[model samples]
Target: MTKDANAATQEKLGGILEARDWSRMHEAWHEDVVDHDPAPDQAPGLAGIVDFWKEFTTAFPDVTLEADPLVVTDDFITAVFTIHGTHTGPFQGHEPTGREFTVRGIQVSKFVDGKIAERWGSTDQKGIEEQLQLGTSDAQFVSKD
Candidate 1:
């Protein structure tokens, strides 16, 4: 991938997150995108991304991503951003808590052709737990990972 191609892939990724376009995300991602689960037990892939976003974006249609600088290279890219959303529905098997939260995370993506070949990202686990009113020490979450 050339530098231009890299930048375009990065831009498209950011757009996917910003638009909350699950269909586009399914299209833009490779069948196997890697994710660095804060909960290490959770393996990462397209199914993980799709499941999380499908429920999250559905609950928070106003979810948005914000950031400034995005790194682009020949076949890799990274973006630092904050995702903001409100809890308007169920999450993590918990009932609505009606809480709003923002989580800052960074993602590095490997591109092959025009699609994301892989990805690894991290975000605020504590904040999510807090927002969901799930006890911080919930053992089920550990097992769920």
Candidate 2:
């Protein structure tokens, strides 16, 4: 079960984030998946989640997420990750800044039948804004290779 959960999570992340395969989302997310921390103006359920990602990808076409070691227990998996991207399009009512940013985030997902049924998490939005507006760097927050 753990292996299944891990594989599902990996496939979900890779397919959506890396490959930009929105069509495969249904295979990894339950139809009624709950997001505990939905973004502002985001709707409900799987379609909403997909819409959110679509908008996000539009804003940062070259975005990438690098996750640290995951913590899995039973039906739950938690990951700490860093989001790297450049603001190249409109986002949250703000025009493009063309600035690169790195923001850290953590997400906890609950899997049911190998699909993500629920998730709770938050990212450093304030930090991202600072990087964009002030042209500050998040180098201090980045993980060492």
Clashes of each: 0, 0
TM-score for all models, in order of appearance: 0.76, 0.86
In candidate 1, position 139 carries an lDDT of 27
What lDDT does the true structure give each of the candidates? 0.65, 0.75
lDDT of 1 at 20: 64
The candidate 1 region of ten consecutive residues with least summed lDDT is 136-145
- Report the lDDT tens digits of candidate 1 across residue range 1-145: 6868777656676677667666777566777766544233344777767666766666666777775457888887777777777778876666677778776777777788767776666666676677656657542221111
Per-residue accuracy of model 2 over 33-76 as CA lDDT, tens digit each: 98878877777888878887887888888988877967777688
Judge candidate 2 at residue 75 and give its lDDT.
Answer: 86
TM-score of 1: 0.76
